[model samples]
Target: MASSIRDELLKVLIEHQPHFLSGEEISRRVGCSRAAIWKHIEELRHEGYEIEAKPRNGYRLVYRPDRVAPEELAPHLQTKRFGRHIRYEYSTPSTQTLAHQWAREGAPEGAVVIAEEQVQGKGRMGRTWHSPPQTGVWMSLILRPPISLAEASQLTLLASVGVQQGIKRVTGLPIQIKWPNDLLIHGKKVCGILTELRGEQDQIHYMIIGIGINVNTTSEHWPEELKKIATSLAIESGGHLHRATLIAAILKELEEVYQEYLNSGFRVIKSKWEQAAGMLGKTITARTPQGLITGVAERLNESGALLIRTDQGVIPVYSADIDWKEI
Candidate 1:
């Protein structure tokens, strides 16, 4: 198929780095004819790669695209197997949806599904996640942890910590994790994590952690309603960013944290997450299905639920809408 040909061509380009390969030579290596090789070269060029084709010299890949293709990401990703099996899609309904199907079909742990654009992306509480074309990281990672359902919420915290670390490493931005799983940069929403699980009474089948980061998108790219609250990496850093590099870093960090969580306990990650939490020890209001509770955010329980000290008493919140307030 086209992808197989592209991978072979990419291997040749990487080996030849800054050199050129004749059309005939490339065709022979790829098991394709010269005309077919040229066609694939044109396709790569259309995907934002700068390939130079001379009269008789050959074809040289002057520049690779910044898109999150496996070849582009694999070089930078340092994880053992997190992104080793990545399914990159130029456009899709949602990475989470695709990942769910893969998980159900027994995809291996650390399998990643990423998309450039999501037509039906989702946020928490059935909200629509804004995923513009080629401007953000819309990814879902499949994890099959040997844990119970009661401890599933900890994965959200772990993912938030991973994202915060990845962004900080790449951009050096002072990002903070809001309660549950929202990444904030300069007090605006920059990333969101949605954790979905499938399991039985005492065992877990698999967990799909979907993460969305608004990278390289500007304020104008957002919908009118979200312009005031939603911000992107370009807006925050005042420039464009390489999406592929960021995605690779994120997967690497996720793999590290996930390994630690599996080997150790959630205690270590919980401590780190609380330190990076935005509203810890601060007065906040949480809107729950039962009612509104005003309290000071205290600590995270073992199950990763938010523990708040209210005027009435200490309460453990499993899930709620959070808003920070000035005390």
Candidate 2:
């Protein structure tokens, strides 16, 4: 019936876990009629939560589906503001587009927009992100950082570090951050971060940081062209993963690092980012607007630009497509 009642009922069921909760006890705790409780329980089952009902025993939570919905993530989420307000869509053109719309409409900082699948998922350099249904994490986060417009791009680096740490915490995978906005595992792409902002000369109004992660995807999920370059946590870890748990972990890690970036500066985040960086000290080629330049990857500047030491000199690349095949 009502969302509040459904939430309460689910909360009670989840809190009790394998132990059964009687109908009368659940009704009292959720402040709903037994009939309503039954209706919602059926609904939960329909949504993929397994509930076992015995003759005398009322119900026990058996299993929960791998979903990134607010209710599903509530148990694993620990951030104070990040993910506090979520807009979940079963299917959308793009979470980034929705997040930008919400941010423009004054949505609070830390509001997240998640989609099970993105028909027109956005990616770096005007590319499209592959987001199959129930396969990956396709979501965007709204932030109102106090940083200036020129410094807004740094959030991409910060988010990359946060997401890599979160994934490592969950699966113990050696997720590494490629320069700019890509995450790799076993030298294959697993995640991408895109940070877009609305700001003036010196101030930022808001920002939408879109994060796409390949969690449970497999060989069949990838197109022939992408199979060689893309990968998933399940593929790398040799097991399936719960998408909600990974989302919660990413949100918690992002919020923690974001707060630190605000309190101190980019120095702390920059250092952490370097540790997880995958391209440093390697020979890589960057396709900038000017032309293709190949060189030894040096380090990132304070502004989040990648510095490559070419035969000519050290060049700071603001935006480009990285080709690390040389590495």
Candidate 3:
């Protein structure tokens, strides 16, 4: 396949990094003709890799693409299985859609679908996520955690913790979690998570953790409606961030915490989620199906449900669209 050839060629170039890898030698290693190897090098350049060639010397990789392609991500990606197998796209309707379909087709756990742009990106409560081309992180992580359907919801919290840790390590910024699946900075939205699953009542077949982060997105990129609510790392930090690098960091942190969640259970994930979660031990309102429940946010129960002490006493909120107003 073309992807395999590219991967093989990239491997050859990377192994000989900072050294001149001749076209003939690359072709020999990649099992392609010299002309074919030249074509592949040109394609890598077109994909944003800066490669230099000389008459007698070979090629040297200078820089990689800004997106999530293997040429850019593979070198930096450090997870065991989380991001080892990735499907990179220039554009897609939604990584979640493709990831779900792949999972149904028996894609293994930790298979990731990442896109530079998402035409139909989504957020929680069926809201539209603003995704711009080559400026953010749009990826779906497929996880088949050994947990029951009842416990599957806890993965959302686990993912929240992962994203928080990843963003913190990448940007060195204070990232807060809006209970459920939102990441905020300076009281504005910077990242959003949408968790979906396909499973039986007792067990989970697969879970898709879709995360969208406004990395290098600018205020001009935001629509009028989102101008006030959304923010990007570039806008917040006054410096543009490398999208591929952030994705690599996220996968690394996510895998570490995810493995802990599976072996140690939700106690560790829950504690970290609570430490970073907004509205915890504060007064907030959640619009549940029963009606709007306004209460003092107490703690997250063992099942990852938000327990609020309202006037009527305590209620465990399994699902709700929560808007945290720091009261």
Instruction: Give the 10-residue window scoring lowest on summed lDDT in candidate 1.
Output: 66-75
Instruction: By TM-score, rank the candidates, best first.
Output: 2, 3, 1
CA lDDT scores, all candidates in order? 0.88, 0.91, 0.88
- With a 3 Å backbone cut-off (N, CA, C), the pairs that clash in candidate 1 are none
Cα lDDT of model 2 overall? 0.91
Candidate 1 local lDDT, residue 7: 75
In candidate 2, what are the lDDT values of residues 215-282, reduced to their tens digit?
99997988899999899999999999999889999999999999999999999998998898888999
TM-score of 2: 0.96
lDDT of 3 by residue, 159-228 (tens): 9999999999988898889888799988789999999998886988899999999999988998998898
Candidate 3 Cα outliers beyond 4 Å, as residue runs: 11-36
Greater-TM-score candidate between 2 and 3: 2
TM-score of each: 0.90, 0.96, 0.91
Q: Could you tell me the lDDT of residue 77 within candidate 1?
A: 75
TM-score of 3: 0.91
